[model samples]
Target: MASHLDLEEQEQLEQVKAFWKQWGNLITWLITAVLLAYAGWQGWNYYQRQEAAKAAAMYDALDQAVQAADADKAASVFNDLRERYAGTVYAAQGALQAAKVQQDKGQADKAMASLTWAADNASDDSYRDIARLRLAGLQIDAKQYDAAAKSLDAIKSADFAALASDRRGDLLLLQNKPAEARAEFQKALAAMDKTLDYRRLIEAKLATLGVAVPADDAASGAAK
Candidate 1:
């Protein structure tokens, strides 16, 4: 009976070895793959953090240049930032800041170029919309009426609809299309948030056009 038990144990050991032989290589390879993937993920996250840190430092330099009101320096730093860190939010913000400095320095062409870059390359939708809005205003100031209209038309976000309408009103008024301007202002007033101080400005615009908000509509808007 002892010899029989020894034989049974030997048979069980052999079955275990056979199972390992069939599956051991596959299990080892799967574990290696998982480890490699985890290491790659960690490396990617580290790279992103390093990139953001570098971008933040460059953005700080751009900010200092802006504070000094050195338009040329700001533009130079902004160009560097855009070239190296265009994928970062800092680059988009730098474009906006540089554009403002350029505009204040009477560099209309440079300002427009910066704004156009932000509008075309910003990762965030709101930033793009803001760039387009400011660019439209600058185009208007330049008396590039057609270009201003094109910029306004490119604004796609509903959040900016009222502002875009207001700008369109300005454009139409400049073109001596008062009737069209009034319609656009009315659209702006209708879309604008009633609680905003800017809404009152739109109302004043309508007033200048010899149009008044109907009493009932005014009351309804106030109630809202």
Candidate 2:
């Protein structure tokens, strides 16, 4: 009976060895792959956190420069942020703020440069739109009618449909095309949100062209 039990135990051990020989390498490789994947994930998370912290610091500097109305410092910081952390949203925002400060400081050319960079490099479409709109406004001020038109035309997003039409109207009006301006302004009025006070401004533009907006339009309500 003791020999019988011994033989049974030996047979069980042999079966275990056979299973290991068949699947041991595969199990080991799978475990190694899992461990490597986990380590890579952890490392990526750590790197992203470090990058975000650094970007946040730079953004704070940009904000301070903007608040102090230091155009040169703002431009310098903005350039640094864009060069080092252009992937961050802060780079686009910093460019916008820097452009404003620089423009206010009689650095119109520099401001346009910053605005152009923001318009071209912003990861977010809305930020790009904002940059392009402001750039168009500046171009209009500089009597760059054709460039302004091109900028407005580049804006393809529907989110800015009303604003783009309004700006186009302004450009046409500046170019002494009153009829075209009137049409664009009317289009702007139609596209604008009824609740926005900005819609009233479009209505006023239409009125300037002797085009009466509908009585139910936000323009009439604002007048009342």
Candidate 3:
């Protein structure tokens, strides 16, 4: 009986060894692959954090230039930040701020350039939308109607539908297309939140077109 038990144990050990011989290399490779992937993920996260830190510092410098009313310096820093860190949220924000500074300084071309860049290259959709909206408004002021139309047409988000319609209505009115403007103003009013003060502005626009807001719509849009 002792000899028989010893033989059984030896057979079991041999079976285990055979199994290991067949699968050991695959198992080892799988574990190595998993460890390497984990390491790569960690490295990517670290790289992103470092980039954000550097971008934040650069954005702060741009903000200081803006606060000092140094348009040239602000533009310079903004160009540098955008070129180096265009993937960062800070670059988009800096573009918006730089555009504001340029606009305040009566640098219409520079403002438009910043806005155009943000519209085209902003990392965030909302930032891009904002840039497009502002760019359209400036283009309208400059009587670049075709460019304004193109910008307005590019706005795809439903959240900005009301504002886009309102701007389009303004553009139509400027071009003496009151009928078209009236339709757009109605769309703006319909899309806008009832509680917003801006809805009143849309109502006023409709009034200019000799159209009155429906009684129910007007009541809903009134202040609570």
Identify the candidate with maximal TM-score. Answer: 3
The best candidate by lDDT is 3
Cα lDDT listed for each candidate = 0.93, 0.91, 0.95
Of candidate 2, the 10-residue stretch with the lowest lDDT total is 215-224
Query: Per-residue alpha-carbon lDDT of model 3 for 1-224, expressed as tens digits?
Result: 99999999999999989998999899999999999999999999999999999999999999999999889999999999999999999999999999999999999999999999999999999999999999999999999999999999999999999999999999999999999999999999989998888998999989978998888878887855
As a TM-score, model 1 comes out at: 0.88
lDDT (Cα, 0-100) at 210 in candidate 3: 94
Off by over 4 Å in 1: 1-13, 215-224
**1-224: candidate 2 lDDT, tens digit per residue:** 99999999999999999999999999999999999999999999999899989988998998999899999999999999999989888889998999999999999999999999999999899999999999999999999999999889989889998899999999999999999999999888888778778887887888888988777785445754
Candidate 1 steric clashes: 0
Give all TM-scores, in the order shown. 0.88, 0.89, 0.91
Clash list (residue pairs), candidate 3: none
Sorted by TM-score (best first), the order is: 3, 2, 1
lDDT of 2 at 104: 94
